[model samples]
Target: MFTRIRMVVLATNAEGSPDLFLTTVDATGTQYEHGRHYDMALPRARDEGYETPMIAFDQYDAAARMLRRAATFIEGGDAATGN
Candidate 1:
């Protein structure tokens, strides 16, 4: 069966800081796997002379784990799925 895969990019900026970008690719297929990339620089922000934003990989990994857990719940998994 063909499952739907979706890519989501999240960007954030502090009040006085540059914008940070993150991208996640999620697969809604049988096994449910995901891939993510973080710390991507925003060209516009750079072009306008804004400092390049930074994202800690540890933080991104934690967030990605949380998102995966949420996805498991959204899929209606039980204790058997370790969700």
Candidate 2:
């Protein structure tokens, strides 16, 4: 429970039938980072020496989203410019 929460994944206890609450499953030790902070900082991140966030390999969707945010920052899109 100490680890950062990326997904609120849960499994119902139909087989064992735990009362009051469902069980938690830790399938992968490799956790995915949610980059909202990085997204918000995108406008000035590069200027301040903050590189674009990195998602894990084969995670094309997350990678694409990060790229799009960087692109927006570069293009002067909706992201607020200036420090």
Candidate 3:
């Protein structure tokens, strides 16, 4: 399985609040690879029972910018230790 820090935004709903539905992304490799991981995650979620709206990190968005920075940190660390 992939590992990464995920940011989830929860909103209140009539169904007892704290609805457990959110998207995820892998915090490894370049931003492009991160996106690839996201792409696979979406369909997997639908298969497992996720009907809520999800947010994707696009190329020119702040989320993508943040992922890029994270990618730099992760990639830089990997290179240093010969991963």
Best-performing candidate as measured by lDDT: 3
2 versus 3: better TM-score goes to: 3
lDDT by candidate, in order shown: 0.41, 0.33, 0.49
Indicate the TM-score of model 3.
Answer: 0.31
Pairs that clash in candidate 2: none
lDDT of 3 at 50: 51
TM-score of each: 0.30, 0.23, 0.31
lDDT of 3 at 36: 64
lDDT of 3 by residue, 1-83 (tens): 45553543323334544333345655556644546655645564455455446443434457655655666667775533343
Error of 2 at 75 (Å): 1.1
Clashing pairs in 1: none
